[model samples]
Target: MVECGAKHLIYVSRSAGKSKDDENFLHELQVHGCRTQTFAEDVADSSLIKKVVQNAAKPIAGVIQMSMILKVQGTWNLHNAIPGKDLDFFVLFSSLSGILGQIGQVNYAAANTFLKAFVQYRYSLGLPASVLDISAMADIGYVSNRPSVLAQLRCAGMQMLKEPDVLDALRLAILRSLPTPSAAYETTSTMATGFHSVSNPAHLATAVATDTSILDDEETSGELLAIQIGKQLLTFMLSTESEEELDLGRAPSDMGVDFLVSIEIRNSWRQSFRSEITVLGILNAHSLKDLGKMAAKNLKEKFERRNEAMK
Candidate 1:
C-alpha cells in the first residue's frame, strides 16, 4: 500500500478477530485514504480464502500464520495463494522452531522446514514479488514452560558474560560488524573474556582480579565455552558474508545434535548492514550420547509394550 501512492492503508486480518481494536484500526486507515476488508472465515479454508483474495485490490499482501510441524497443510495454503498476479507478497509468520526443531514439536519442525524451502525457491526464481518468512526466537515473549536443559544453558551462557565488561562485548560485536553488514546491534557487557577452566573457581577469580600474564597451574575453567561459541558464530558471519545458500539437501534431523542451541547471524540488507544475531538453544541433557541412549531405550520399551498390548 505504501508503494502505490496510498496515503492511507487499512489491513483487516481475520486473525485479528472481532476485537474493537480491529474496527478502530480500520477507522484509522480510512483517515489516510485506505479501507479495511475483514474475512469471517478460517485462514486455512482454501476455497473461501481464494474467493477473498480474488476480491481484494491489486497487489495483495496476505499474512499467513503457519507452524513448522504441519508441512503439507501449511504449504498447500501457501501454494493456493500463488495463482494470482495481484498477490504481490505472501508474508509467512513462521517460527525458529522450523529452523531449530523443538523436542516435542516434530510436526512443527516439518511444516517450518517446508515454508523455508518454499520461500527460498520463490526467491531463486526471481519472482516479481517475494515470499518473506518472519521467524521468532524461543527466548523472547512469554516462556513460562521453558525446559530445564535450556535454563541450564542460559545460566551457563550468562555466567560466562559476568567475566567480560558488557560495553566491551558490545564494542566487539560492533567491531566484528565493521567488516560486515550490521544496521543496529546490541551485545551484553559480559561477553569479553573467554571461558575459564572448570576446576578452580578461585584461580578463575584471581585471573579476573590480578594482571596475571601466566596461566594458573591450579587448573581453572570459566564460561569460555559460551564465548568461544559466540565468537565462532560471529566469525562465520564475517566469513560467509550472508551469501551462503540454505543447504536444501540436508534433512532437518541431520542438521546437528546442537541444532536448536545454534545461533544464526544473517545479513538481511541489500547493502552491508549490521549483524542480526538470533540464538536458538535446546534444553536437553548435558551428554548427547547418554541422552540418545536413554531415549532409544525408552522408545524400545514403549514399542515392546505396544506389541504386547496388540497381541
Candidate 2:
C-alpha cells in the first residue's frame, strides 16, 4: 500500500522475528523505488517504545501499531506522542480475545479491555487523531504447545467434576441463568453489531425496546465516519469464526497461527478507549478431565440411541 504514494505509516508488532521479516519487507519496498523508515520494538519495553517514537521522522501523518500482550495504556502512550500537526490518523490493531476473554488467556483479556477503554478516552480528548480497533481472526501461531504436569493435574480434576452428570448440571444451571433482555438507543457508528454494553447492563437489557434517534443537528465528519465504519466492517468480517477454530494451544512459530489484526481508538480526555487484556495461560488438569468425561458421556448417549434404534 505504501508504494502507491502512501507517504506516512507506522507498523508495530511484538514478534521477535520481525527483524528478519522486516529486511525482506524493506527490500521489496526498495525495489519499488519507495523510501521508508521502519522501527522494530517491543510494546512491553517502555524505553524501547519511547526511543522508537522519538526517532520517527518529522511531519508524521499516520501511526499504526499492534497491541498484543502489552497493556492498552502502553499503546495509548505511543499514540499520544504523535504530534497533532503531523498526525492525521492513528490505527490500532486489537484482538477478539481482548473483547471476549479466552479460556486460558486472562492476562490477554485484561490488556485488551484496557485498550477498549483507552479508545473512548481518546474520543473524549477531541484529538484530531481517530482510533480504529480492527478485530481480526486469531493468529494460530501464538498458541502454546507445551503440556506440563500442571495441565495433567487440572485435567484430572475435571474428571472428578464431571462424575455423575455434575458438570452437565452446572452447565445447564448457568445457561438457565442467562437473561434475555433488549433495549434500543443511538449507538456509536464504530460499535459492532454484537458489541454489548457490559458496562451498562440495565441499558443493554432494554436496548431492543428503545428506538435510536439519529441526531441530524450533530454531524460527524466524513473522515471520522469513514474510519468508524471501516473498523466496524473489518471487525465483523474478521471475527466470523469460532475461537476454537484458531487452536490457541499452538505457538506463534506454528504454520497454522499466522497473524491477527484489530483496531482501537484512544481519547484520554474521556477515559474511554479500547483495551485488550489477557490472562496467563493456565491448564488445569481437572478441567480437562471434566471435559473429557463430558465428551465420553455424550458419546455414550449417542451409542445408546443407536442401539435402541437397532432393537
> Model 2, 237-269: lDDT tens per residue?
454644224332232123111123112211210
Q: What is the C-alpha lDDT of each candidate?
A: 0.37, 0.38
lDDT (Cα, tens digit) per residue for candidate 1, span 1-311:
33234552323234543778677866766777765566665556677657766676654543434333334564566466656333444444444455546678787667755665555444444332122222222343223235664465455442222212332222222222111112333211111122332222232233222212111111111122222223333344454423133232332223342433332322211011111223321223333232223323333344445546755
Deviation in Å, model 1, residue 194 alpha carbon: 23
Q: After superposition, how far is residue 11 of candidate 2 from its true place, in Å?
A: 4.2
Candidate No. with top TM-score: 2
User: What's model 1's lDDT at 201?
Assistant: 25
Candidate 2 TM-score, true structure as reference: 0.42
Worst 10 residues of 2 by lDDT: 261-270
Superposition TM-score, candidate 1 onto the true structure:
0.39
